[model samples]
Target chain A: MSVLAFIDQSEGQVKKGAYEALSYAVKLASQLGTTAEAVVLGKLTDDIAALGKYGVKKIYHVADEQLNHLDAQVFADVIAQVARAAGAKIIVLSNNSDGKAIAPGLSVKLKAGLVSGAVALPDTGNGFTVKKSVFSGKAFAHVAIKTDIKIIALNPNSFSITEAGGGNAEVSAFAAAVNTPKVKVTAVNKVKGDVPLGEAEVVVSGGRGLKGPENWGMIEELAKLLGAATACSRPVADTHWRPHHEHVGQTGLAIAPNLYIAIGISGAIQHLAGVNRSKTIVVINKDPEAPFFKAADYGIVGDAFEVVPGIIEEVKKLKGVA
Target chain B: MKILVCISKSPDTTAKIAFTDNNTKFATDGVQWIINPYDEWYALVKAIEIKEKDPSAVIHLVTVGGADVEPVIRKALALGGDEAIRINADTPDSYYVACQIAETAKQGSYDLVLAGKETIDHNSASIGGMLAELLELPYVSLATKLELNGNTVLITREIEGGEESCEVNTPVVVSCQKGMAEARIPNMRGIMAARTKPLKVVEPVAADSFTGIVSFELPPAKAGVKLIPADNPAELVRVLHEEAKVI
Candidate 1:
């Protein structure tokens, strides 16, 4: 009846979301009067035992290089085996790209109830009900999972990461049947030296109001000054002013950063759907009537060319950087 | 090659969201429905593009919903699918919907299955994976690009900080998003031809829904925006540091 968390990693490095998932699983396990354990696939730069500080009692390591790359099927197969071996009644994962790939297939394999995008811990008092975001963060739904074994994909940044001081987990090397992946990897194109937009605490985004792609220098400069990631509206990406990966909206990447600053965006419902989950939103636009202002915590009715440079200078001054 | 593209109906992006029946159901009054943008712009259109490259390719659409979703399916047909299958049922959850689609897809024996990364309404992104598992097919999520070469397909999918290109054979499930293909509008001739395209409405297969919605609630409304003077950008910085502490 122990709870198990999948520790997601890429290229031998643990993802930031893993700690939050581990913490969530640990808390849930305590509520169930059981201990929490974690399963990590592939090799890692970080020590597996050190993760116990996040409250995991045990860590299972499958130290195969093939596990370094993500193949959802292979990952699911291994996870299901580990879950059965560990007698895990609940499986927790971060609802990032990797978790999204694995959870559904794992549910099918285990015949367990599955919920993705879970924003809070399950209410286990009566039945296991999880609160999650639906309609692209426009509303919330409390969903009940009825199966004996339940799977939850916790939304990134939704749960707070808690750590215990100087704790050590017992790490065990586990072996499972590693299947040859059907998906053949040809190439990888990683974003260079920018704060990953999904993990960024502060995101500075621009829209068509930036006038042209050439005007984006200031946006990038401001983002660098603030140690933030840069994002764009759909039109900006559609028009090829920015790459599509940076587009944030309903049909684009939905994000929940701590602070999202929008410049020159009119805040269409499509655009707002992706960003409404941000803890704080700041809008800077020339139009006071822009719908984004209504959704924002702070607003500055001004042109980006003038206003953004001023903000950049002020941020620089505040940070004491040249 | 036979390809199965999954389509879903979503409220138009501009529609106002509200709930009815004690917040247990979405209020459908006066909401205009449209094909989910990701499905229309990426999955369905990419399938159409494949057909354009190879005339021998046949594209079939599948959707799980009642008669209200037929128009959205027809729109997909007009965009170039050869036919569409409608599993007539209310979607209780993603698993049940995936099971229904899997039943139909099993009969079709499609070489490839495609769906939007997720529907705008549910935003679950679980259908493709569940459907793949049910049908015993390889599944890929967030495919940004796909190119078919004989029996193998080259796919580029979005990862955390970048994109990875991989190759997979036919009989696979792929959930598509932006960059897979551009959105297409139905031409008059295409719309006229869509009326003759076969629309098969099959009864849903019996499946258990593991999850049920206990209740729905709206997020708390934001306190109105605090407007700062355009000239005082420094005040914005000061307030962020001292008050919000987010900077």
Candidate 2:
């Protein structure tokens, strides 16, 4: 029996979240006294063998070019078949977009218990129980999986990825037949940014207090200087001050970064629900009584225009960029 | 054309969250319930917009809850859904809910199935995908945009840093997010029409839940903030760089 990691990729490149899932599964496999194996669908640009650093003992590569584009049904079908063939007792996937689209289907198809948004490693001492974020990060829930097979969709950035120095793993060709996709790809529109929000270690976000979208240069400057991603509150996205993808709130993307800095955001409960998982939170707002200040690890009560300039100058100095 | 939109109720965003019974039950006192924003603003409105464009289309709203959830259903009907189905069961488990919906959709022969990406209360974004799996159909999750032309449906969804469009045939399931459509408010005519619109309450189908909640926990409170004076904003940055080492 093995713990199977479903490593997600886009355009043949592995996503950062997949590394976290791989590392997480490896640890779980150790605890369960089983080996960790991984299955990758579609093409891979990187050497699959190198992922052994994460402690995966074996890698299964489907190498199907047609599997590059995602169709949840087709993807789930192949992954389920791989799980059955591999005798996997637990399947691990990152709770990112790809995992979100496919994990639930796989659970239903395999009759496995699924725990999405898993934050911590499971506690197997008593019975298998996984801790997960519920109510949009407002609370955590421990769910006990009673099924023989368990499926966990680890939240992106929730688990730290560990590397095993100079390890090697065996890679075998998986000859699983690819199903003809019912979903047809039309066009792809990618957000033009260097750091994807889901994988960013630090995030600098802005809100309506910035006045207008035109004044977003300061927010971008801080994010760029820190090599962090940029995000905004829901109202900013709703008003088209920023792209919808950058919106971080209960209804938007839930992010868990090492550091999350909010500028001009009032820290509405809905907005905080998406970002409260950050290891540290900083709030800069003119209102001292802003609700966000309560949740912030560090807070500066001042105008964003006045405070952000100082932060930008300091970050640039620290980075020696200018 | 038939479109079934799944509507869900959740505590108002500003409601204070607390637990009862040794952190096993969500406290309801002083909480205000509303239609989950994702369901009302995206999935339901998108379905309404589609129905308005094509007069031949019928929009049906479904929810799994008791009679207390009727107002939300009527409100959905008021927003132009032709009918509503209330599955009289309230087990917050996603798999059981998905099974109930799958049975209902199969009986109705729905051409398209739609739901919010997730419910705010549970944040379990599983129902749509599970429904598709149970019904043996294709599912597109977190679709920001959906367009139906005849039997073919076009969907635009977020994937990592990019957005991709896909085309699928009829009998497709889609979980909607923002950018699908704007939120709608019921007009006087629509409100009156909703009073008489059909709301069929059916008993839930039996489905075993494989997961049980052990307990609920609130995240630890933040260590009170270290307030940096407005004149010295650099202090905050320095602390982040040195103390937190996050920069």
Candidate 3:
């Protein structure tokens, strides 16, 4: 039995989380005393052999042009076929958008036990149990998979990426029957942002305390200075001060960044659920009693108008940017 | 067109989360259950919008749980569903829940299946894809916007950085999230009418769950915040750089 990691890519470029999944699969493979391999669909622009840095010994490339865009059904079918052919006892992938789309379908196709948003490695010592965040990171659950074939989709940033000693993975072209896609892609609109929120190391978010969209200049300036992505609270989005896509909360996007700066936002439990996983939280609010301060690692009890601009100047001074 | 809308009960957004039974089950004493917002506000509301356009469209709400879920189901009916069905099982296993939902959808032969992207409690976000696979139908996930055009449906779903527009024929599954539809509260007339709505209780079909929860854990509590006075905003940046090292 082998462990197979499905690499997710966009526009021929590998996603940041794919490497983490590959590394995870490699570690799991060693735990199971099996070999680790990778499978990549769609044509690629990057060197597939270089993925060996993640410790996978071999990779199966199905360079199909039709597989470029995500068709969850087709992707699941191809991965299932490859997993069956390779005698894969375990399959690993990212729990990002693409992985979420594919893993569930693949589990059904293979009748394998599946765990999504797994935050840690499986406890193989105790019947292959996996720990995952539940209730929007408010809690964690240890789930045991009972099936022989298991699939795990790791939450992005949950596992660190460890590079192997050094070697190129043997890249072999594998052919599988690609089914016609039931979902037809009409258009792809890439939201051009300075930094994608999901991949952003630092995030500066605003709330209703900004007062209006007009006051958002300082928020943007602070985010720009910090090289961070900008986000907003649900009320800001609901009031049309920001786009719904920028909203981060229980009902919105859940992000896990290294540094999260909240300005003018009262930390509600719902909002905290979305972002509690962030490594370091900084809250700037006029109200010292704001619940957000409790969760913040560092808090400034001040007005965003006064505090944000002051912080911006300080950051500029620290970074030596005029 | 027949639309099967899957709804689930979740703790109110502000409800305090705790576990009981050796951390194996969620604590429910004094907790209030409501329809999951994504399911109620987005999935069910959007289905109601479709039915508004075409009165022939039938929206049936389905939930998997014991009698406790019926109240939440009734609220969904009040919003606009024609009826509700309760699968008599209370399991945390998402695969089992998906199996139960698939069985109902198959028997109904619905042309469309809609569900929230994920329930707020477990947040597995897998039912739509799993159900679509089991039914051998197309699946579109995390859809922010959707419109029905004859037999084909136009959808806009959130990707990693941006969004993608796609088209799929009916007999498809979609998991709805924010921006799909506006949330609505049940008015007096709607609430009264909901009382008469058909609520069928069905026994679960034989299905094996491949996963089980062994235990639950709460994340470590955050250390108390380190406060910085308003006058020393620059000090905050200094600490972030030299101490926190985030800047």
Complex DockQ per candidate: 0.84, 0.82, 0.82
lDDT of 2: 0.91
lDDT of 3: 0.91
lDDT of 1 by residue, A1-322 (tens): 9999999987777887788789999999889899999999998988889998898879999988788888888899999999999999999999888898999999999999898999999999998999999998898899999999999999888898898653899999999888888887778788888888887889999999999999999999989988899999999999999999999998888899988999999999999999999998999999999999999999999988989999999999999988
- In model 2, state the lDDT of residue A226: 86
lDDT of 3 by residue, B1-247 (tens): 9999999999998888899998988899899999999999999999999999999999999999999788899888888989999999977587898999999999999999999999898888899999999999988999999999999999999887788999999989999999999888989899999999999999999898989999999999988899999888888998888898888
Q: How close is candidate 3 at the interface, in terms of C-alpha RMSD after superposing the true interface residues? A: 1.1
Angstrom error of the Cα, residue B44, model 2: value is 0.8
Q: Is 1 or 3 the stronger prediction by TM-score?
A: 1
TM-score of 3: 0.98
Instruction: Report, to 2 decimal places, the DockQ of model 2.
Output: 0.82
> Could you tell me every candidate's TM-score relative to the true structure?
0.98, 0.98, 0.98
Interface RMSD of 1: 0.9
In model 1, state the lDDT of residue A293: 99
Q: What local lDDT does model 3 show for residue A137? A: 84
